[model samples]
Target: MHGRCISCRFFANDPALIEATFPGLNVLSSAYGSVRSDAGICSRHEFFLSSWQRCRDFESGDNEGKDALLPVEKKLIGYSIGFGAVLLGILVWISYTFFPTGH
Candidate 1:
């Protein structure tokens, strides 16, 4: 038995994380974005594997015991929040226009 692949720096389980790490990959080939769920690429070995899969060459990605979000992921979350705020504003405007609170 070996350590989990997710703990390896070479393994990237999230498709968005993978795409962000390897920019323009999707443009080069859409197939790269179609990996199965919980599956990630082993950049060192050049193969895709599930997150739960084990490897003998397991090494910490220097982020032991830390659940830090990647910079790109942080930006993505910010963008999502901003979009949600804008959407909420639009919905409130529509509601106020269509339905009045005080008759």
Candidate 2:
């Protein structure tokens, strides 16, 4: 059995990303926290597993459909932008109404 979970292929659906980040996870994927922070459903164990987790049932899997996905971060970024825009609009309206120019 491979000592490292990353070598077991069950490590990540997108194994390439895991491999690339394994060397320098601290510098590359710092925004998402640790490399192991990424979690996915492990087919072998029929449960979720972190990228850094290892198990006896680990087996090689393909990465055809799997992608280096970051859905949560994407959604959060979208929501933040939307909320900021709304706040900026409100600020502009408030300033215009309270500080009307003398015409």
Candidate 3:
């Protein structure tokens, strides 16, 4: 598991009870269910995993840490920003090259 169930919003200290009572509520089919050692279940997404694997549904943690974009996400954002800046620079250069600068 990527994150610890101890901190998840849907995390129950004991999943066997909740899981047994509520079927299909928190299925392990999604988000790679947690290991057996982790008794708690993510009630929201019904996921379980080692707190060290990779938590995609873990919520209720520090906003800064929980909200930080993944490496691939960050790369995409960086690429977009860089592309925008370059595009703006190109437009400015074109304006200077083709259009007369008042100054």
Candidate 2 has a TM-score of 0.34
Q: Report, for every candidate in turn, its global Cα lDDT versus the true structure.
A: 0.76, 0.60, 0.61
lDDT, candidate 3, 1-103, per-residue tens: 5555566666664555646655785664422245445454556766554444346666764322455678999999999999999999999888888886643
Query: For model 2, how does the per-residue alpha-carbon lDDT over 1-103 read when each residue is reduced to its tens digit?
Result: 4343544555454545545535675465542445545565454566546556667675655433446658998899999999999999998888889877832
| Best prediction by TM-score | 1
Clashes of each: 0, 0, 11
Q: Which stretches of candidate 1 lie over 4 Å from their true place?
A: 17-35, 62-92, 95-103
The lowest-lDDT stretch of 10 consecutive residues in candidate 2 is: 28-37
Candidate 1 lDDT tens digits, 3-103: 68877888876677667766787786643454456677898898867778777888877534567888999999999999999999998888888887742
- Residue pairs clashing in model 2 are none
Which ranges of candidate 3 are over 4 A from the true structure?
1-66, 101-103
Candidate 1 residue 88 C-alpha distance from true site, Å:
4.3
Arrange candidates, best TM-score first: 1, 3, 2
lDDT (0-100) at residue 101 of candidate 3? 66
Residue-level lDDT for 5 in candidate 1? 83
